[model samples]
Target: MNFGREAMMTSDIECDVRSLGDSGKQRAIFAHFDSLSVGQSLVLVNNRPIEHLRDAFDAEYAGSYSWQELEPRPRSWRVRIGKTASDALPRVVGHTSSGDLDRRSAVWSLPIQRRHDLDVTIVTLAPGTSTTPRPGPAVDTLVHVLAGTGTVTTELRDLDLDPGTLLWLPRHTPRSYTAGPDGLRYLRVRPHQQSPVPDSDGPW
Candidate 1:
């Protein structure tokens, strides 16, 4: 058994509120750990005066917060806790409007739980708008069309995707997307460490 690989699996990204002053100002902290072991827990040392850590993963809730054990697989295998926010988190809100991409494109990132891996985001593209071309880091990605229609063009080929379609692209492969007349919506799933970077080689 290769415990070496398992032992080296730790959260590559972490965000927390670090401090708060008597003046009612708050500070945030973001840390990246090299590796983590199974059964070992990561603690959020928060100095905020709030009774509960605002963004810490809580174990007694559902929907608003969630935590998963990520090891030996890209997907989180265990759900130790769940979401618990009375109101939606920042990432849960829709940040884009119709015909918004041509002016100012947007990406709404959801709360994700992964260790040394990538996660997924549901992206909504405005009608007649397209994404900036770019290659992702060294990781595979799968785009699952949730609603609407679109065309995905890559350096290798072009694919017309609609609801129920799933498109796969490898890392660093140049790619772009154009929304249909009705607009496009899809879930982009990839490794946590390697996200798709915007490429300028193609038109947006």
Candidate 2:
């Protein structure tokens, strides 16, 4: 498998939350954790007991992740959280909204378990942001809005989007998206096994 330069070069990420406020700390840690790839791990350094985070992590990732308390310090605690190398059985994967972390014009995240047959992504677009028009992938796509609103422009027409809106885009259709004033967060799913678009010249 192609582990990619990212996962190969950054095997361990350190998240220091000692200086952040109570509420900000968990978000910071989780953001770092969410960015990790298989075989990569996060080293969390904090000022308080982080045993509670273990329960939170267990509740989110359970069998697909590992946690180990490192050597204790006088005032700091450290724990190594790793995404396990083993594959998980078919099961429910939990995820909340991207919320404040998806602050960029556009951002996307995959659920913990990435399956070979499907490419599932949570996409967030900041207010007034838009995705450049491009020919859709070779595989069919299903997009479901989870929050906010947007307009999806396809070859045929512009479709308005709202929370709970679900759209189907057939393979090879040209499409783009523009976020509403409130911004947009949606789920995009495609069949990973389908052949990709032939051209590789477009922006990523």
Candidate 3:
């Protein structure tokens, strides 16, 4: 796979908390965690260390998640938060945020991941990059804009995109994407259609 496509396979859902502000940050973090199925995780990329989020986890999800600090610097931090296998189900909650971190991804453009019965595809496009025509069914295919800005072109019309944008792809529909000057990135979630996914092909 090419670099762009290779990047989408990671199990981590990138949540830039800077957009959530001080008041909304924790709720946003909780929403991301709530969106995960058992055994899935979210990688929080933030402007500063978030020890408080850990404390919140202690109160809300104690013994339910495993936390790991990936990068801790004077100016920034990256935390890997994963949900453990549990009898409880994760709710599909809405998210709100402003922005966080001001850097571009170096490797991988689009990565494919499996979170339980769902296939989560992360698509990262460089500025001026456009996707090959993608076909999907309506309703089953859900799209969320994670970062940057872009345009989505369908047979009906062309739409401008920004962070937090949600879109749907209808059955037999084909769509194209183009990244803006800063590049564009989004997550596509859908029901898993095939069986016997290889261990090597599973989410990280």
Off by over 4 Å in 2: 1-87, 90-94, 105-108, 111-115, 194-204
- Worst-scoring 10-residue span by lDDT in model 2: 1-10
Which residue window of length 10 is worst by lDDT in model 1?
A: 25-34
TM-score of each: 0.49, 0.50, 0.42
Q: Write the per-residue lDDT of candidate 1 for residues 1-204, one digit (tens) a residue.
A: 332224333542332334345333222321211122323333332333333433433311224543443232322221122223442343333432222322323355445542224454667778877877786556677878867788988888889989999888877778888888877877777756634564223222
Local distance difference test values of all predictions, in order: 0.50, 0.70, 0.65
- The digit string of per-residue lDDT tens for model 3 on 1-204 reads 232222322787878887667888877887888888887878887888866678667546657898877766655577778889553245533332222323333222222322346565656677877766655443366778888898988888898988999987765566788888877777767666555534221221
Identify the superior model by lDDT, candidate 1 or candidate 3: 3
How does residue 98 of candidate 1 score in lDDT?
28
Worst 10 residues of 3 by lDDT: 106-115
**Given candidate 2, what's the lDDT at residue 83?**
82
Sorted on TM-score, highest at the top, how do the candidates line up?
Answer: 2, 1, 3
Whichever of 1 and 2 has more lDDT, that candidate is 2
